[model samples]
Target chain A: MKKKENKIITDDIMIEVEKISMRFNLGIEKGFSLKQGFINLFNIKKRKELKAKRKKNVFWALKNVSFKVNRGEVVGFIGANGAGKSTLLKVVAGVMKPTEGNVDVYGNICPMIELGAGFDPQLTARENIYLNGAVMGYSKNLIDLKFEEIVEFSELREFLDVPVQNFSSGMVARLAFSIATIVDPEILIVDEILSVGDIAFQAKSEKKMMNMIGGGTTVLYVSHSLAAIKKICTKVIWLEKGKIKMVGGTEVCDKYLKYMEGK
Target chain B: MINNLKYVYAKYSFLLKQLVERDFKVKYKRSILGIFWSLLYPVLMMAVMAIVFSNVFKFSTPGVSYLTYLLIGLTYFSYFSEASNLAMSSVVANFSLINKVYMPKYIFPLSKCIFVGINFLLTLIPLYIIIIATGTGLNWAHLFLPYSFICLFLFTVGMGFILSTIAVFIRDMFYIYGIIITIWTYLTPIMYDIKIISNSTLQFLMKLNPLYQIINFARSIILYHNVPTLGQWAGCGVSGLVIFIIGIIVFKKNQDKFIYYV
Candidate 1:
C-alpha cells in the first residue's frame, strides 16, 4: 500500500513543457500523399524554393512555447479565439504531439478538453457514463462505486435510462461534466467546459470546480470568462496569437481586459 | 515501448471489453431477432452455397461429406472476411475518439477485431451442429480447431492494424477495398476446389494465397478427420506470423502521424 502512490520527486512541479511547437500544413493541396510525392521527385528544385515561401500553406499553431506548472497550482488560461489555447491544452494533455520539443507531465491528468467526446449517442445515459469512465481509464469497480453519486450530482436521476441522443445539450453537458470530474485527478485540464449549461448549473459546477481546486488539485483552465478566471485562478497566463503575452496574477487579466477593449 | 505488458493489459482489458460489448449490442440493435441473426446468417449462406456448389464443383475432400467440407471452409472464410473488413475501418470509424483521447490507437483496431471475432465464434455453434447433423463424428483432430482459429485471428488483427492505418490516409480505401475483397473471395477456395484450376501456373499462384492455406488447413481436420501435414501446418503458421509482423511494423511506424491524418 505504501508503494502504490506516485513517488513525489524533489520538486513539486507537475508539468514542464520545453519549447514545444506545432506546425500544420493547412491548405488542401499543401500536404502530398505517396503518389503525388513520387511525381514531385523529378520536379524538386523549383518546388523546394516554393515550399520555403509557405505563403498561407504552413501555419504554426504554437511557436517555441514553454511553460511550467507546479502541483496544487490553480492556473487559468485567458486568450482570444485562435490564440492556440486549445492547441496548447491538447499538447499538455498528450492528445497531440508537438512537431518539435517535448512535454513532461509528472501526474495523472484528466483532460476534459471537450465534454462527451467519446459517448455513443445511441447508448443510455447510464451506459455513456460507464463508457466515458473507461475513456478516462477508470476501472469498472471504481465506476461502480461512483455511479450513484455521479447520477445524483448531474440531477439526471429521472432520465438515467434514456438514450443520450435524445437529451438536450445542457443535459449532455451536465452528465459529461459530472462523470469527468468524479475522480480526483492530479491535473485537470478544463477547456471552455464551464460555458455550457444554465446559470444555476454554472453556479453548481463552479462550486464543484472550487471544491476540487481547494483540494490541492492542479488545474489548467481555458475559458472566455475573465471574471471566473479572476475569481478562482491563483495565476493567469494570457496568450495572443499562439504566443504567451503575459504570466502573472490577476493584474495580467486586467491588462488583458484592457487590451481586449481597443486601448 | 510496450515493455509493461501486464499493466497495459490490465488497464486496457476493461476498455476493450466495453468497446467490444457496445459494438456487439449495436450490431443487433435494429434487427428483430437480435443475436439469433448471428446463428442464422452463416447457416443459411453455407446451406445455399453447399447445395449449389456440391453438384457443380467437386474436386477434393477425399474422406468427408460435402456439407462437412463446405462448413469448414465457410467458417474460416467468414471469420477472415468479417475480421479483416471490420478491422480495416476500425481506426477510421473512431475519428472522434482518436483526435480527442490519448490511447495507443491500436486499441480501436483490436477492439473491432475482437467484436467481429465474438460473432465469428458464436457462428461456430451452428457450424459444428451442421457437421454433427451431416453424420461426421467429432474426432481427436478437433483439438486443432482452436489453434487454427487463433492463427487466423492474429492474421486478421495484424491486417486490421495495417489496413486501418492506411485507410486513414487514403480516404478512397473503402471503395478500393470493396473490389479487392471481391477478387480475394474468388481467388480463395471457399465455394470451389483449388484443384479445378487445371493450369499448373494458375494452380501454383492459387496455392500462394494465404486464405487458401488457412482454409485447407482447417478442412484437413473438420472435413478429412486427420492431422494436417507438417508442411500444411507450417504454411498456415508462417503466413499468419509473417503478415502479422508486417502489419505491426507498418502500423507502429505510421501510428504517431495518425493524429494529423485522421
Candidate 2:
C-alpha cells in the first residue's frame, strides 16, 4: 500500500487567493450607422494614427477576495446565488482568470465543478468513462486499470454499453461522481453537484469525500446544504454580494443561515 | 513549438476522438449510406461543375482529363471550405463544455478542423477509385499526398483558430462567414488553372492568397503529376508555421475571456 503523507503546517499553504476580483460587461451599445460609419471609415486615416481607447463598462463578479487554505483542510465556501462561489472555484481550477488579483495553487486539482461537462450524449457509458477520465487528465492506462472499479461504483454494469443520453439524471450523476473520485487528486473542488444524486448515492459520495479527506487531501467545497457543510467542513467562509462576509468554524453557519432566512 | 503541440494534443486528445466519431456518426445515423454522403456531395459537385465549366471554358489541362483536374482541385478546396465553416461555430457549439472545463480552448476549433480532415480522408477513397478507373498513371509524387495534407491541416487549423476565437466575441461572425467563404472561393483558382491567369497583376494577387498555393500544391501532385514549384512549397511552409504560431498565441490570450462573452 502507498503510505499517505502527513500534513505539516510549516508555511506550506496549498492554495492562496489574494485580492482576487472578476469583472464582466453586461450590456450592449447602439450600432454604428452608415453616415457616422462612413465618416469614421474616412477618419480611419486619423484613427490609425491614434490608438482607440477601450471603454470601461463592466461589473465585478468577485471583489477583493483573499484567503489561504492549508494542506489537509476541508474548507466550505457558502454563498447565495451570484455570490461568486462558482467563479472563485473556476479561478482556482485554472479555468477562469481573475481580473484584479493573483491565485496560486499547488498540487493537482480535480474540480468536480461541472459534473460530466465532457460527456458526449451519443457515446456509450463505457466510452464516456474513458473520454471523461482523459478529459480530467487521466491517462488511458490509468483509466483501463480503474475501469472495473468505476463501473462497479457507478452501479451501471448492465447499462455500460448504453448511450449516456438514454441514462437518467441520477445515473449520470452517479457515473460522474464515480469518475471524479477514481483519480484521488491532491486537491478536490466540488460545486453543488453532490445534491443531484439520490440518498444512497449521496451517502456513497460523502463516504468517498471523507476517505479522500482522511488521506490528507485538501478540499474546497461549494454547496448550499448547510447541514452537509457543518458535517464535512472544518472551516467555513460565507460570501454575500461578491464579498466575503465571514470566515470561521461551523458556528459561522448559524449566522449565515440566519442571514439567509432574514433575507 | 513542439511543447505547445504536445500540450494541445494532451489536453484535446479525448475531445478530438469524441468529436471525430461524432462528426462521422451524426451525419450518417439516419441515412442509409452512412459516411458515403461525405464522398457523394463532393463528387456530385465536381461532376456538375466539370460539365458546366468544361463547355464554357476551353482551357486545356495538360497530362490529365478535365474531370480528373476538376475533382482534384475541388476535393482540396472543399476540405478548406468545410473546415472553415465548421470552425466558425465550433466554440459556440461547445459553449457548455467551454464554460465549464479548464482544457485548452483551442481544442474546440482544432478538433473541428481534425473532424473535417477525417471526412476529407474518407472522401479521398472515391477520388482514388476515379483516378485508377480513369487510367491516370499514379506517379511517385502521389506518395507525397500525406505531406501536402499535413501542410493543409496546419493552414486550416491556423485559420480555424483565428475565426473561432473571433466568432466568440463577434455576434455577427456566423452570418458573415458564408459571404466571406463565397468571396474567398472565387479568389482561389479551384475552377481554373493558375497558368490560365495571363496578367502579371492577377497572378500576383492570386499568389498572395495562401489557399491558392496550398490548392495548387495538392492539384499539381494529384492531377498534373508534377511537383509544386520551390517557391510555392516554401510559401506554404513559411505561412503554415507563422499562421499556426499566431493562432496559438491568439487562442491562449483570448481563451480566458471566452466564458464572459459566451
Candidate 3:
C-alpha cells in the first residue's frame, strides 16, 4: 500500500475529496397512528391516512473516501457494480453533495454520467442539442458554433428536426457522446456513457478521449472494462464495497485482475 | 450578494429563457383562442362572480363598480396564487435538470413567477379597457400599480422559494397547497369587500393575512383612486423583503440536498 504521505498534493492537483461519505435513509415510514388503527376497528372514525407503511432500509453508499487527481491526468476508477465509483464521481461533479466531509474541484466539469438524461423527449433533436448543450454549461453561441460538428459526429444529420424519443438507443448514445465532448472541458467525468455505442463508435470515443487527454484535460473515468482502463488510464484506483482496495500504477490493476480471476 | 446574482444570471440565463418560452408556448399551444385565453379566463370568472355575489350577497363596495373591483383584485391575487402554486412543484417537476446540473435552485421558482407575471401583465390590458369603458376616470395613484406589482412579485417569489424547497421533502404538499389556496382565496377579500366584514376581531385577523394588504393596496390604487395608506404600503414592502431574504437563505442552504430528495 502507498503511504499516506505519498498522497500529498503536488503542483498539478485538480480535484480533491477529503474524508467524504454519503448516507441515505431508506424504509422510513410516516403516517397512521396506533390509536387510529385501534379506532378503525369500529369504522366510526375512518382512517384519513392514505399511505401505507413503507419498508425501512438504509445505505452507506460511500464511506470516508479520500482521493486527489492532478491536472491532465486520466485516472480510471474500477470497481464492482455497487462499489461507490459513480457516487464519488457525482460528488466531484457537484451533482450530489457528500453527507459528510468536503470536495474541492477546480475548473469546469463536464460530467457524461447518464448521457441524454437532460434531453427532453418531446423536443426535436436540434432543440435537444441546444438544450443539452446549455445544461452541460455551453453558451448558446458555443452550441451554435459546434452544431454542425455535433450532428456530423452523431451521423444523425437527416433527423435533426425529429424528436429524440424517436431515435434508437444507439443513436441517442452517439448524440449524447457528441454533445458531451463538444466543449473542451477542463475536467471530464465520464461514467459508463461511452460503452453503449457500436465498435466503430467506441473506437471513435477512445480516440476522442485520447485527444482530450493529450490536450491536457484531466479525466476521472469510471468503467467496468478493465481492458479499456488498462489502455487509457495512467493511474488506477481499485474499489471494493465503497472502500479503496489499492491505488497505484497499472501494476496495481494487474493484481486486481488476478484477484478477480481467482488465480 | 451582487456577485452571486451576477453568477446566477450568467449561468442560468439560458435555462430561464428556455423555461419561460416553454411556459408561454406550451400554455396556449392547443387552445382555440391561443394567448387571448389569458384575458378571457379572468374576465369570464369576474363576470360570473360579479353577477352571483353583487346581487345574491348584496355586498356594498365603495368608489368602483363591483365588476371592476373584482377584476382588479382577482387579477392580482390570481398572479400570486398561480405563480406560488406552480412554483411549489417547479423543483420536483424538473428532476432531470436538478439531478444533472448545479445552478441556483431559486431560479426554478423565480422563472415560474416571472412567466406568470408576464401573463398577469397581459391580462391587465383588458382590465384597463373595461375600467375606461365603465366611465371611470384614471387617477395618478394608478401609476403606482407598477410598484405594487413589484411588491407582489417579490412576495410571490419568496413564498415560492420557501414552499418549493419544503415540498421536496414533504410529498403531500401538493394536496396541502390545494386546500390552502382554496381557503386562502376566500379569506383574502378577493370576491368580497373588506369594509362589509363588521366584526372587529375577524377584521383584525384578516389584516394579519399578508395577501390581504397586497390585494387591498392594488384595489385602493386602481379602483378606489386613492394611494394605499402608509401603514399598509410599508407592511407590504417590509414583509415582502423579509420573506424574500429568508427564502433565498433557506433555498441556498438546502439546495444541495434537493437532488437526492427530488
* Clashes by residue pair, model 1: none
**B41-144 in candidate 3: lDDT tens per residue?**
88888888888888888865766787777888889889988999999999989887767665556777988999999999998988898889876668898878
lDDT of 1 at B4: 68
DockQ of 2: 0.37
DockQ for each candidate? 0.61, 0.37, 0.49
Name the runs in model 3 displaced over 4 angstroms.
A1-10, A29-56, A197-202
lDDT of 3 at B153: 89
**Which candidate model has the greater lDDT, 1 or 3?**
1
**Best first by DockQ, ranked:** 1, 3, 2
Q: What tens-digit string does per-residue lDDT give for candidate 3 at A10-47?
A: 57678888988887655333333567557675674343
Per-residue error at B100 for model 3, in Å?
A: 2.8
User: Please, what are the lDDT tens digits per residue for candidate 2 over residues B74-184?
Assistant: 787789889977886888898887677677677778878888898899878878878887777588898867866887888888888888888988867887888998898
Computed on C-alpha atoms, the DockQ of candidate 3 is 0.49
Task: Output the chain A TM-score of model 1.
Answer: 0.86
| Candidate 2, CAPRI quality class derived from DockQ | acceptable
